[model samples]
Target chain A: MSSPAQQSAGKPVAFVSAQALRARMHDAVNDPHLRQSFRGAMDFLMAKRAAQFPDQGELDSLRSLSESIRQYSLSKLPDLLEQLEANLTRNGVQVHWAETPEEANAIMLGIAQRHAARLIVKGKSMVSEEIEFNHAMEAAGVGALESDMGEYIVQLAGEKPSHIIMPAIHQTKQQIAKLFAEHIPGVDYTDNVDALIQIGRRVLREKFEVADIGLSGVNFAVAETGTLCLVENEGNGRMCTTVPKVHIAITGIEKVVEKLEHVAPLFSILTRSATGQAVSTYFNMISGPRRGEDKDGPEEVHLVLLDNGRSQAYADEQLRKTLQCIRCGACMNHCPVYTRIGGHAYGTTYPGPIGKIISPHMMGLEQTHLLPTASSLCGACGEVCPVKIPIPELLIRLRGEANSAPHANPAMVGQGAAYDPKISLLWKLWARLYARPATYRAFTWLATRFRALTPTQQSGWTAARTPLKPASRRLRDMVKDRR
Target chain B: MSSPSHGANTPRTYPSRPQAVYFYGTCLVDMFVPEAGMDAITLLEREGIRVIFPDNQTCCGQPAFTSGFPDEARRVVEAQLDLFPGNHPIVVPSGSCAGMIRWHWEKVCAGDPALKARAEAISARTYELAEFLLHVLGFNRKDEGPATTVTLHTSCSARREMGTHLVGRELLARLGNVTLAHHDHESECCGFGGTFSLKHPDVSTAMVSDKVASLKATGASQLVTADCGCMLNITQRAAREDQDAGRACASLPGEHLATFLLRRTGGSPCGDQK
Candidate 1:
C-alpha cells in the first residue's frame, strides 16, 4: 500500500484561463471511450429518474413544497444557526465556525491533536473533499482513510471523486480489480464486482476497529432537535461515526433547517432524484455524544460549520438560489453538455451543472468564469432540480456579471474578472445596428443583394457543418412586394 | 403562465382566430431561411387570416440576452416592442424566438424600468406559430400530396419554456398521410444555443454530432422542426454532397415544420412532394 502522505493525494484545480479550459474540453471530447461511457451512463440515469417520477402531479407538488422549505429555511438562516448552536451545546456537542478552508482545516487538526489521533476514518463526504481534509491530516503526520467503498476506490487511485454520489463511477471494474490486486494483500486480479467489493470491505473493516477518530458529512442539520442527518445506502457511514471514540462532522452553513419536519419532504425527493431510490439503507441521525449508558456512540462529538463563500452567494438575491441545492446529481445526469464532457474535465470539487453555478462562489470568477459559459442554456439542470434552482437563468446572469464594468459595490466575489473591452464594444455596436429598424433593414438588404460574397468558411460554425448563407430576399422584402 | 409552469398539462387557454395576426419573422428566417417564414404565412392566410408582416421587425434580443449582454438585448427587444402596437395576436414562426418573446421579453427588460410594462403586455399576446395553428386556427391538414415519414426536433427552449414539443407533435399527428418517425433523446438539445456554438465550437460540434447521429438513425427521409436555429444547426451537420445527387444533395433535408405542414396541406411548390 502507499504511504500515508502519498495516500491523501487530492488536488484542487488550478486557476486556468478560458483557453486552458477549452483545451481540456477539447481533449475530453476527442476521447471516444470517455464520450461513449458518459453517454450510456447518463442515458441510464435519465431513464431511471424518469421511471421514478411516473406521476407528474405528485412530483410537481413535492418539488414545490421542497422549494418553499429550502427558501424559507435560508431566509431565517442566522436565527436557525444560533438555535442549532445553543441546542447542540446543551447536548454536550462542541460547535466551531470556519470562514475559509484554512480555518476549517486548522480546527479539524486541532481536534485531532487534542485526542492524539493516529488514524481517522471517513464516511463519503464531498464537503471534506471541498476542504481537502485528507491532505491536511496526512500533512500533520496522521493517516486518514475513506471507509465508503466508492471513496476507497478513488482514494486508492489518488484521484478526486468524479461524481459526488458515485465517487468511482468513472472507473471500470477491470481497472478496480487491478487496483485491489496491487494495493491489498493476497488479492488476485478478478473483474468480478462482488469479489472486488469484498476485498475493499475487508481492508476498511480493519481500519474501522483501530481508527482513533471518525469523520462524516451532514445532509441536514435540524435546529429544533439539534440533530445531524446523514443519508447513505452503505452502512459505512454508521460505522465511521459510531466505532471511534471521537466523531467530527462538517457541512456547509446552508444545510440547516428550522424544524425536523422539513427534512421529510427534502429526503423523500432527494433520494428519488439522486439515484432513483425511494429510500437509502441508512439515515443516521446523531444528536450528540454517548452519555447515560449509551454504549455504542462516540464519547465526544464535534460539528464544523463551513462558510467558504456561501455567504457571498447568499448576499445577492438572484445568486442565493445556488445554495438551494440538496446535492442531488440529477442535473449532471440530465445536462447535455455534461453528458459529452463528463465530470473530470470540469476540474472543480463539484462537477456538471450544479458545479458551474456554485464553483464561482467558492473559487472566484477569475478562476471559474469559463464554467458558466460552458453550458448551452438547455435548462435541463433547472428542469430536473428538485428545488427548482433556475440554473440556466443564473448562468445568463453570471455571464452578465462577468462581462459588465465593475461597480464599486459588486455582488459577486470575482465580478468583472472576464470583462474584455473589445467584446463589450462589439456587442454595443451590434446593439446599435439591431435596435435601429432602418439600419438593420439596410444592412440585411445589402447582404442579400451581394449574397454571392458570403464566405464558405465562417469561424467555428463551418468546422462540422456547411456555411450559412443569406437568402436572395429578406422576409420583410418578400412580404412587402407581395401584391 | 409562469416560465416554470410550461409543462405539457398546464391547461392553456388560447384566443379565437382573429381577422388578422402580426407575423414576427425571426432573424434566422429573415436572412437564411425565408422560405419557412413564407410557407408559415401561406398556411395562416389559407385559413382566412390576414398576415401583417411588420416592416421594422428584426432579431429578438435572445442572442445578446444569453450572451450576458443584457443592456444590448434590452435595447433590441425594446425596439421590437414598439412594432406590434395592436391588440391582435402576434404569431412567431420560430419556437425559440416565440418562447423568448413570450417568456423572456419582460426578463431582458428588467434593466429598463420604463419598458418593463410594455414588454410584459407584448409577451402576454405572443404565441408560437404551431401552437397558434393548433389552438386558434384549428388547422386540419389534408395531406394533399403523397405519404412520407419525417422526424421532428424540438429545441430545448420550446420543450421546457413553452411545451411546444407536444404542440409540434400534435400538429404532425393532425396530418392524415404523414408518419412522424421517433428519434432517440428527442427532448435533448441540438446544440444551436445561439452564441454557444460560436464560443465553444468543439463542444458544440460534438453535441450536434450526437444529435445528428440520433436524427439520422430515425431513418426518416425528411427531418422537420419548429425552431429555425435547430433547423440551421441540424441541416448543416446533415448536409452531405452526393456526386449522383448533383446540386440537390442535401442527403437528409432538415426543414421547418411550417414548410413541411404547408407542403402536406396546401401542396408543395414542386407539386406532389415527398
Candidate 2:
C-alpha cells in the first residue's frame, strides 16, 4: 500500500490501482468469511429489491420514468432550486447555498457558531465526506460524531468508506473487533457481528444526548411540499435529525426532486438497486421540524444546498445525467472490480461505479486523478444503473478531464505538464494500426519476415506467446493469386 | 418476421428445406476466426437455415465508435444498412458486435437523417447467436458428452451489453456431460476494450492477468468465453503462466465458445473434421 505521503504528493496509489485491486480480490475474495458475508448481504438486498416491485416488468418502466424525471430535474435545475429554497424557507427552515466546498464549510461553521455547537452528531452523507466536513468541523472546534454504523467504523479506523451504501464494507469483523478493542470502552474484543452493533449503539446514544446540533445528509428534498426524505438501515439518521435542538441537512443541489410523488418510485429502484433491499429499514421524511402533534422532532431545521462543481458537471452534455444517481450503490455491489478490493482501495468518499464518476467532480481532478482510470470501461455500471447514467462513458470522460488537471500526474521528477498530447497521439495511432486487420497483418509480416533483425525472446509479449510466425499464406496473397 | 421464400431466395439443393437466415458474422470471426463463422453457418445449415452473407457489410462500427470516432464510424453504419436492407433477423456470433448493431447503431446514427431509417431497420433484426438459438430456434442442449469440468467466463460485453450470460448458459447446457463452474467476478471486464489493450497495454495486461487468475481459482480445466478478444487475452495469459510454471499450468487451458461446443457436439473443427 502506498503511504499517505505518496497520496498527498499526488503520486498514484498502487493499492488503489484497478489491476492490483482486482488481483488482490481474486485471492482474498475466496476466503469463506468474505464470500459468505458477500453472499448473505447481496442475497438479502436482492430479495428486498425484488419484493419491492410487485411485478418484474415494472423495472424497465421505472427505469425509463426515473431517467425522464432526472432529465427534467437537470434541465430545470435553476427553477427547482428557487422553488426548493422558497418552500423550505416557508416551512420555517433556513436554506443556504454554497457554490464551493470552502463556502459550504464556512456556512456549516456559521450554523455551529449560532448554536454554540460543541459536539455535533451526524448521519451518513457522501456529500459530507465530499467536503471532508468532519475535519473542517474539528478544526473549527466542533467535535463531530458519526452515528451511522459503517461511517462510525471507518471513522475510528481513519479511512474512507470502501463502499458507498455499506460504508464499512471493506473492514472484516476481525478488523472491527480490533478497532473496537482499541477505541471503544469496556468491550472484550470479539468478532461477533451483534456485539459490534451493540458497542456502536451505546457509543452513539451518548453523543445524541450531548449533541446541540444534528447534521444529516439529505437523500432527496421534495420541492413541491418542502419534504426531505432520508433512507437508512441503522436508524441513526432519524436520531441525529430529531434528538438535537437544531437540525441541519446538507446535500448536493441535484438531490432535489420536483415533487413528493417522484420520491416513491425512485426510492423503489434506489433501495433495490443499492442493496437489493425492497425497502430501507427506515425511510424518514421531515417537513420542516416540530409540528403541533409531533411528539419527537427537532424544534428548528436548516438545509444547506451545495453546488460545489455540480453546476459544472450539469453543464457538460455527457456528464449531467450523473446527477440522476440516488446513491443506491447498486453499481458498486454488482461491480466486479469493487466487490473484490472493497471500497477503501478507492481512497475517496464515494467508492465503486458512482465514485469513479463523482469523485473527480467533487474533489477536483488534482486530488482524484486516479479514480477515473480505475475502470475497465466494460459498461457493466450502465447495465445495472436504475436511472441509466451510462457510468462507463462518464468514467472515460473523467479520465480525459483528469489529464488536463495540473496535479493529475506527479511532477515528472521536477516541474512540467502532467500529460502531453503528442505522446498520447502516437499511442492512439499505434492502437488504431493494431485494431485494423489489414494494417496489423502487413506490420506483422514485416516484423516476422525479418525475425532475426527483431529482438529475440523479449519478456512481455514476445517471450510469452509466439508472434504470428509469418502466415505461410497471407489472405491478400491468396486472393491476388486466385484473381 | 420475413419468411424464407419472401425475398431473393437462391436456394441450393443440399437435400434439405433451407430455413432462411441472415449472417451477421462479427468483425472478430470475420477477420480472425473465420472458422467460427463457417462453423456457425454450417451448424445453422445442418438445422435447415439458409445463411445469407451480405457481402456489402463493412464493420459493426463498434471499434471506431467506441474509440470516440463516431463521426468516422457513421460511414461503416451506412455500409451495414446497405448490406442488410430490412428485417431478416440477422444472427451474429460475437456478443459485443451484436450488441453494437442491435442497440447502439440507431442511437449513433440518429444524428444523420439519411442513415437514421436504415440504422433503425437493422437494430430491430440483429441478434446474438445464443439468443437466436434458444429464443428463435428453441434449440436446447440435451445430449451427454465426455464428462469434463469447465468454467464459463462471462465476457463483460456479453453479460452487460448483449445479455448473453443466461442465454449462453442455456445453449451450453445442451452439451452432454459438461458442468459449467462460475468464477466469483464473472461480470468484470477482461480488459479487451478494443484498442484499449494496445493503447493502455499495461492496464489491459493487468486486467487480463486478474481474469486468468480468477478463472484458475474455479478449479476448472477449461475457461470458455464467447468473445474472441477475451479468448485471446485469457489464452495469452494462460500460455504466459504455463511458460512460467512449466508443468504446473498444464492442467488449465482456454477455449472459445465455437471450439468448446464443436468438440462436445462430436463435430471436429473444419481444419480437423475433413
Candidate 3:
C-alpha cells in the first residue's frame, strides 16, 4: 500500500501542481455559492449558444468550414507569420517578436519607456495575464488600468480572471457591488448588473482620457491585408486602440491568418460561441498608425507577436491543433468539469478544456500534466468547439505523451512526473496475465472465491460508494455449469 | 448511422436479421452484473437470433486505453480480437465497451496493417445492444409490462461515439408502458470515466451527485442506463448515500437497458431478479 504522500506524488501535477489545484477544487466544490454561480451562468450561456444555431445543418456546415480555415492557416503558419510581419511593416506598423513571456513583457516595457508613458489603458487580454503584464508594469512604476468591466473588477480585487471570456464569472453581482463600494471612492453598493457596469464605465472612461499608451489583444491578425481585428461587447477595446497616442497589440503567433476573409467565419462563430451574442458591439480593426489624414487614431501603432511556447506546439503535428482555438469559451461553458468547480481550480491563465490541452505546451508537462487528467474524457468540449478542434483526442494524446518514458522523445518539452516504473510494470504484469486463458481463469476463480475478502475501505472508490466486490461465481464457470 | 471506411476497404453490411451474433459480454457485465449479459442474450434469443458466447473473452481494453496506456490496451485488445475470428455480428451489452471495439480498436492498432485490418473488420460488425435491436434486427416487440416511470443515463461514449442514446430512447419508446421522464442536463457525463472516478473521486462524486439529483428530480423510481460502468457508479453512489442517511440499501436502483428490456418485454423471468 502506498502512503498518502506517495499516492499524491504518483498523480500528475499542474503549473500550480495537483496538490494546490485539488485543494482549491475542494474548497470550490464545497462552496455552494461558487457551484451555483457557475452552474447558472454556464447553463445560461449554453442555452444562448444553442439558440443561436437553431439549424443543425448550418451549424455543422459552418463548423466544418471554420475547421478547414484553421487547419489551412496552421499548415502555413511560418510563411503566414513572415507575410504578416512584412505586410504590417509595409503599412507603417512596427512589428516586434518575442520568443518568451519575459521577452514579450520586456519588449512592451521598452516601448512604453521609450514613449515615456506613465498610465496605460488596457483591453481584456488573456495573453497579458499569462505574462503577468500588470505586475511587470507596476514594478516599472507604470500604472496599467483594466478598461473591460469584468477585468476591472478582478483587477481591483487583486484577483486573476477565473473564466477566460467571462473574466469575473466566479464573482456574484452582490460581491462586485461590495467590491466596488469598498474599493471605489464615494460609491454605494448596488446589486444591479447595469448599475455596476455604469459605475465601472464611469471609472474606466477617465483612465482612457489620461492614459498615454493603449494596450490591447488581437482576435485575428490578417496576413493578406495587414489588419489586426479586435472583438468586444464593451467599447473599451476601441478606446484602448484609438484614444491614446500610441497603441500596442500583443498576441500569440498562432493568431495570424492567411487572409481577411477567413476572419469572417471565425468571428461569426466566435461571438456566438462566446456569450452567445450574434455580434459584438465593437469590431475594431487596426491596420496602421494614424496617417496625416486620419481623424481619430493612435499616432503610433505597434504589433508584438509573442511565441511564448507556441512555437513548441507548432513543432508537433498533433499538438498544433491547440493553436486552432479562437479564444471562444464555448468549450468551458459547456464543460461539466468547468461548470462544477468553476475556472479558478485550473490554476492557469486559460481554464477548462482549452486550458487543459494548451497549458502543457506553455508551462511544460512537469507543471501542467494534471490539467489534462482533470477531465473525464466526456468529449463535450470537442463537440461544441466551433473550429472543431479534437480536444478530447488531444487530451488523450497529451496523457500518452506525459506518461511516455523518459528520453522516449528527447525533443519534447517536459519530463512527465507521472511516469512511474512501478506502475508501468504493474500494467505489463496485468496484460501478461490476461494474455492467456489459464492465468485469466485462475485469477477470476480466486477473485470470486475470496469475494468477501474485498476491502471495505477502498480509497476514493468506497468514499461515497459501496465497495465493488467480485461475484460469487465467474461468468465462464456459470456458462460451463449451464452447458 | 453506418460505419465509415478507414482505408481502401468498403463498408461491410450485416443482415437485417442475423442468424447468429457473437455476444461480447463485456468484462463489467461478466463479473459485476452477469444478469445484464444473460438478459442481453435472452433478448437476442427471443428474436430468433442465435447467441454465441466465447468464454475466453475478458475485456476490450478501454480501461487501459483511456488511462494513457495504449500499448497495454493494444495487447489486451489483440487477445480479444483473436478470440472472435468469424464474420458474425459482434453485439455488446454496453455502449462504452462496444464503442471501444468499434471506433478505437483500429486506432490502437494503427501501425500494423494486418492487425489494423482485423480491428476494422471486427469494428465494422460491432454494435451496441440497443443499436443492434433497433437498427439491425428492427425488433418491434409490443410492450407487455405494467407502467413504470424511469429516466435513462447515457454514457459519454455511447452518446458521442455510437449515438446509442437515441437508439435507447427509441427502443424505450416502443415499450408503450414505460414512461420516459425528461431530466435536465441529461446529456452530461455521469463521471464514471473508468479510472477517472478513482483518480479524481471528489470531482467524480460531485458530478454523480448532480446526476443523481437530476435523476431524482424527474420523480422516477428507477433509472435506466445502457453502460455498466455508469450503472455501477450511479447505483453504488446512491447506495452509499442511502447508507450515510441510515436508510435502506440501494435507494435508487439503476438497471442496465438490457435488463429493463428483457423484463419489460417478457423475454425471461430470471433477468428480473436482479
Best by TM-score: 1
Docking class of 1: medium
Count of backbone clashes for each model? Answer: 0, 15, 3
- Better-scoring candidate (TM-score), 1 or 2: 1
Show pairs that collide, candidate 3.
A14-A17, A14-A367, A15-A367
lDDT of 2 by residue, A1-483 (tens): 121211222222223533343344445444556545654565465456546656645776788788788887778888888898889889988899898878888998998998888888899988888787877777676777788989888777767666678877667889999988877657789999998899888878978998899989998889888888999888899999999989989999999889888888888788878876778899999888788888988998989888876876787777787888888887776665565455655666677788878766665665565556556668767776888788876665565454432453431111112246664465456455544546655665575456456654534344333332332333233223333
Question: For model 1, which pairs clash?
Answer: none
TM-score of chain B of each: 0.92, 0.86, 0.93
* Cα shift from native, residue B70, model 2 (Å): 4.4
Q: Which candidate gets the maximum lDDT versus the true structure?
A: 1
1 against 3, candidate with superior DockQ: 1
User: Residue A409 in candidate 2 has what lDDT?
Assistant: 44
Q: Is the docking of candidate 2 incorrect, acceptable, medium or high quality?
A: incorrect
**Cα lDDT of model 2 by residue, B115-217, tens digit:** 7877767766677776676677766545546788788876776676666678778777777688888886576788667665554444456567667877889
lDDT of each: 0.86, 0.69, 0.84
DockQ list for all candidates: 0.69, 0.19, 0.49
Instruction: Write the residue-wise lDDT of candidate 3 on A236-285 in tens digits.
Output: 99999999999999999999899989999999999998988899999988
